[model samples]
Target: MDQTNDTAETLTPQTVRHSILWRVIFYFATASIALSIVVSAALVVWNYEQQTEAFRERLEDIRVGYSESLGSSLWFYDEIQIQSQVKGIMNLEAISYVRVTDNLNINIEVGTRPHHSDIETLPIEFNGKPIGVLEIAFDRDAVIAKASRAAISTMIAQLVSLLLLASMLGVVVHTLINRRISEMAAQVNDRLSSNQYSPLAISTGKDKDEIDLLIQAFNALSEQMIDQLEQKTQAQQQLKTINLELEDRVKERTHNLQKTVDELNQTLAELHATQGKLIEAEKLSSLGGMVAGIAHEINTPLGLCITIHSYINDNYQVMKRAFDGGGMRKQDFVDFMGMMDESLGILDKNLQRAAHLIKSFKQVSEDQTGEHIRRFSLHDYLHEIMETLSPKFKQTQHKVEIDCSENLWMETFAGSISQVVTNLVMNSLVHAFEHTKEGLIRIQAAEEKGNIVIRYTDNGCGLSAEAKHKIFEPFYTTKRGQGGTGLGMHLVYNIVHQRLKGEIQVEEADQGAAFRMVIPKITEESNVQ
Candidate 1:
């Protein structure tokens, strides 16, 4: 039982052939051998029939011999003689024995009740007419006796022939079908042994027979497996590449964002630093211009003082020595006192000039730093600021004109207002004065619609349409690098709008530019909610 179990368990593909291949080869070969055996047996039986017919013809000849015998022919009643005559005529050697029979029951035979052991009738004809029946028993007993022996020998030969044919058939069948299987097996084994499976080239047979069908199926299976494996591998590789690319792109975008943030921060710092520099620059520029103007204003007065002092000194010394000598009379004394009065008058006149200079300087200084917001004369503020900016106006031949309503009470930032005025005047003198030799700056302050409207316009170099549009944005300037900070108008805009709490506007003039500040008068407090 265990051995049976082991035999059953031992069957595997490696150990045995595929059932389909085996079944096809088995059925094909079985059909071929079975058909051959059937045809051979049919031929043997057909030959046996022909041999049996030959035996009947020989029996007919024996019957004809019996009929033609002289004694047996007409009214022959001697049975023994008839039989002897029949035997004498057919005196051929292979006859084992002979017998005769009459129409009556009287018959005699040399053999016995069963001489031949197998007897049968043969037709007897005379002149094409059935006369009687002739029973010629060919010596089947002796034939059987010999045939049994021959049959045994023939069977042995046939068995040998069948064995030889079967051996050859089995060899041919195995070579045709089984050999193909072995070849396919080798291919399968080779595919397994070698590691190269991708785009595996599976081999197949040209014939579409049973064995070739199996190989075709196996080749197809192998090719399919290779295709699926390659597709899966390519998908995995593509997935890996996509993931790597996504990671790289994310990192690159993050780095770029960080860099952008750093750049923006740096730009803010630069803007703040630039603002500081601009403030200091405007201050220093204003101070230098103020010094130049003050010095110019003082020059004439100081020159006059120096001349008066020298005149008094010269006259006082000469008159003092003459009066001390006493060679002069009372009239000489009167003349001396008169000269002293003239010298004192000259000193007094020069002293008045110096006093006027000091007063104007004081007023301008006070206006520059004044923080108090009050109702002051618009005309007075314009004159003081313009006179303080005289040196710059002198540098560029710009004439500043003041047109005032003579009484406009506008409450606003005074220091910033002065600064705005100073910047505007300088902008005209410096930036707008391309035609400086013929430049004219007009400042007009009037009460219009319950508001104080101040228009500062210049006729020197007109602003282009494009330049007028962005004049107030910081760092936007038409002048490229000639000390044009572009912050002047921006500062003016901020002060006019926020510090003074007023509306300011600008427009392109035919010759230069015009700036307007429309400030609400103190009286317009009721107009605001």
Candidate 2:
């Protein structure tokens, strides 16, 4: 008896409800309840809108019919008639209260207005003049009660119908599927536990429904399982062979990967060495061009000096001959002295010009070769560099303008600065003015917030998007074969980024290429290195 009681307690309502048939019925009932609630809410809203519309129509009727009578009563000062007319309006549909107010300060209110009533007011006019106002308050609770009763009836009917349908559906599902499923479950459990593979058997008619198909599938699966059991030993051997082959392949691949990594490392070291050599070659190439330009510039002045020397020598021979022959006079000596003065002055001027050109060339060459820090005016250095580079521009119609403040001075490594400017100027001359005549290159410098901002621009053919992107890359040049080494701008980039520790960027321009560089007034040696 105690065991029976414990068994009954275990099959409690909660456990019993977990059955599939019960769950299907419960879900249907919940859906029916939710749908009923939604329908009821919609029905209530529709009824309220209709009721409110009817209430508005009746209010309009009261306004048109009662305004004139109420106005006549107030104009005649008839208190009894005003009360009678207001009571008449209150008797209309849904109107709970009426109030009449006249110009004479007579206010008459009648009927009881609930807290939730809607009120409307109308002006009372007689003979085209306003006499008083009529207010009507309508009761909404009675209408709401009617709509609620109708909605409740509808919800009850739907809930009953849905529950009946849900019960029938649950019974059908249990009879058609649940009983056969239970039998199949028992057969599968028996086969799994006892290691006896066998087809499940359940009685079925000739209809070939879902249960018949499920039985066929189960029988086929049982035959496949038996075949798998027979091949289990062979499958284990095959798996071992596959794993060994995979291990060998992995070892071979790992060895090859290591070899490839070593090769890559060696290649990278070689590339760095080659790049350093190329950079040195590029610097030397720029220095060689500067030397050639200076030589060409110095030749003209030296040639003039030679010519002047010969002319003075010839004149000295003439004067010495006249003195030695005893034919020299005071006027003749004065004439010879004046001629010597003029010739010597011309010789001295040419010599001084040649000396100045050589001095500027030497200074630029020294800065280009090594790093040297010296306080110098930016304006003077630009003119000096331009003087040395004048040979390249002097032959062309192109002009170079420098716009640096004379007071701006820097005490940093001038070599890098000189290299960067020289490269940029050369780059513009070579690439920027390819097809244009009278091109203008402008270099502007200013000191802002302890940094030197330099803007280099040219009024010539601008750089294409591709060229601008790879301009600083080594061995990248538009004029590949026309004496372009393709390392000028690359060297410039290295000098700015690695030597000066500055930033350079390409900017937009109207008719040409524009580049902006911002260099710090003082740079740390560690940062530069």
Top-lDDT candidate index: 2
Using TM-score, give the best candidate's number: 2
> RMSD (Cα, Å) of candidate 2?
14.5
Tens digits of per-residue lDDT for model 1, 1-529: 5554454344434677355455655665576566656655555565455556767776666665566553234244655566666566346533444555445564444443344345665544445544444444455455554545555555556656665666676677677766665665555545454543432243444666776676666667778988988899999999999999999999999999999999999999998898868865765677567777778866776787788678767776776787688566678668767876876787677777567556655665665556455666667766767666665655555577889866655665556667788888877776778556878889988888877888999887777776678888887777767767787788788777766678888865666788888876662333322
Candidate 2: pairs in clash = none
Model 1 weakest 10-residue run by lDDT: 195-204
Task: Provide the TM-score for each candidate, comma-separated.
Answer: 0.47, 0.59
Backbone Cα, N, C clashes tallied per candidate: 2, 0
Off by more than 4 A, model 1: 1-248, 327-357, 366-375, 393-398, 473-484, 520-529
Per-residue lDDT for 198 in model 1?
36
Quote model 2's TM-score.
0.59
The C-alpha stretches of model 2 lying farther than 4 A from their native spots are 1-240, 320-327
The CA lDDT of each predicted structure is 0.66, 0.84
